[model samples]
Target: MGVHHHKIGGGKLLIAIVLNLILTVVQIVGGIISGSLALLSDALHNFSDVSALTISHVAHTLSSKKATVKETFGYKRAEIIAALFNASVLIAIGIYLIYESFVRFYDPQPVVSVWVVGLGMLGVIVNGGSIWLLEAEAKGNMNIRAAYLHLLGDTLTSVAVVAGGAAMYFWHIYWIDPLISIAIALYLIYASLSLVKESTGVLMEFVPEDLDVEEIAEAVAREPDIKNIHHLHIWRINDREVFLQAHLDFEQNLSLQEVTRRIEKIEKMLKHRFGISHAVLQPEFMRDDEKDLIKGES
Candidate 1:
């Protein structure tokens, strides 16, 4: 029926956004003064995280709107769109950081070790707090998942910066800074690509990966008075909810009341067998038509 809102409060997200913005500015300035590319990269990632969280918060609000004639689905897909945008941004930032890290390798700059270490440790604390705040909501929502990934990336990058700073300070290994940046960028890319693919699937209305249309049709045909099932379609509303639609052929022409009862039975079967949250069915009697399990493109 309806989407369930997580127990998370807008106040918690607002707190996270404020913290990230303040720390991002601090890190950027510190990166410039300290000449730390790793620190600068972490700051950039933190900035992206801030942007992602703001988009998610707005989408979460929009998703609560009711459906209308012009927008039959209302703003339900807003969160999915936000998730796609956030994932795309993460991938772009990751690529830029990787390229920058490679360039830095050729001309490694000497960073002030104390500044990098101090800012990095502060980053870890700040990002860790933000992660805690969004952890619960992220589990069931793709938009929140993108935001969570950003914070998790930032936390990991902060740790990397600290490690690189320590290595450079003790052993004078300046190359470690770019090395850590490269590693963080690669990891971010790897993690965010999955989100991009999943969000894209939803936007494209692709069938859920776990569902088998043939199996569902066979199961529905098992009900008495049902001749066959065809024109089956399934897709996700978001990460948690699934929507299914299909046409059913019956052995006999039934009254409106009997048809309604059969429809309810089919809906219950779909929900129990496939975790389908919503279903639409069209009943037919001895209609001559194609009965393909999946409708082929004309």
Candidate 2:
């Protein structure tokens, strides 16, 4: 399933890159000819998307490589790094746009062509198609979702640029160009901040947001032969791979095999309910109660 998903995602990203490259060329020419700052901003925005998509594609490919002796976790963190890099680029672009918009606001420029506005509308359509293509694979992956959000924002920005251009054509309100650029900058900032938060959570190895540690402990404690679960740890190695480690104390006379079965059941339950695919269970008999499962305690 992972392999299939990787292939599909890679293919979609390639298509997006090709489409965005074409749009970038068109927008750059149109922006120059039409004297529309919004169109130029949108073109720069697409350029950022191209860079982000390239990073995501390379990281996804690297992540599929087998683990080596030195890096036993393989290259799973590559995707997270890619996400961070993309978000940083987004922040930079947002700030740059904000500055340029301020300049354009002071001295508004003429917008020459409604035909270029039509082309901007076509860009919105293309960006929307890219968003839909990436949406399905975005559910289980943070990196892919970030990329998708970038594309989604670009699609909306394209729409605004087209609208602003049309307005300028009829009303000659050239300031709308700068206003639209400012709006795009604000949207990019919001989206990039969100991406940073999510990516940081994963990198810090925080537990999955949907999981409740207390509830998990209670579930294990409820087992017939189990007395307690302690030193429980739950964290994600990446977006889809969650890791869990805990000590399980069993009642007297519960055979090892019985205890194993109970723990396995819990593992299966965690996998099904919480999307945790990796788990490490350490079994302890009642006699070992005084032993600390978590090392380095005072």
Candidate 1 residue-wise lDDT, 64-171, digit = tens: 788899988878889899999999999999899989999999999888989999999999999999999989888888888888999999999999999999998999
Superposing every Cα of model 1 onto the true structure, what RMSD results? Answer: 1.8
Task: Give stretches of model 2 more than 4 Å off.
Answer: 253-255, 286-298
lDDT of 1 at 101: 93
In model 1, what is the error at residue 8, expressed in angstroms?
2.5
Worst 10 residues of 2 by lDDT: 288-297
Misplaced by over 4 Å in model 1 are 1-9
- Cα displacement (angstroms), candidate 2, residue 182, comes to 0.9
Candidate 2 on 1-298: residue-level lDDT in tens? 7788788899999999888889888889888888888999889989888888988988888888889999999999888888888887888998999999999999998888495587789789889998989988878777787788779879988999888988988899999999999999998889889778778888887766888888877876787777777777888778878898988777766777887788889888878877778889888775555444343446
In Å, residue 9's CA in model 2 sits off its true spot by: 1.3
Between which residue pairs do clashes occur in model 2? none
Report the lDDT of model 2 for residue 199: 82
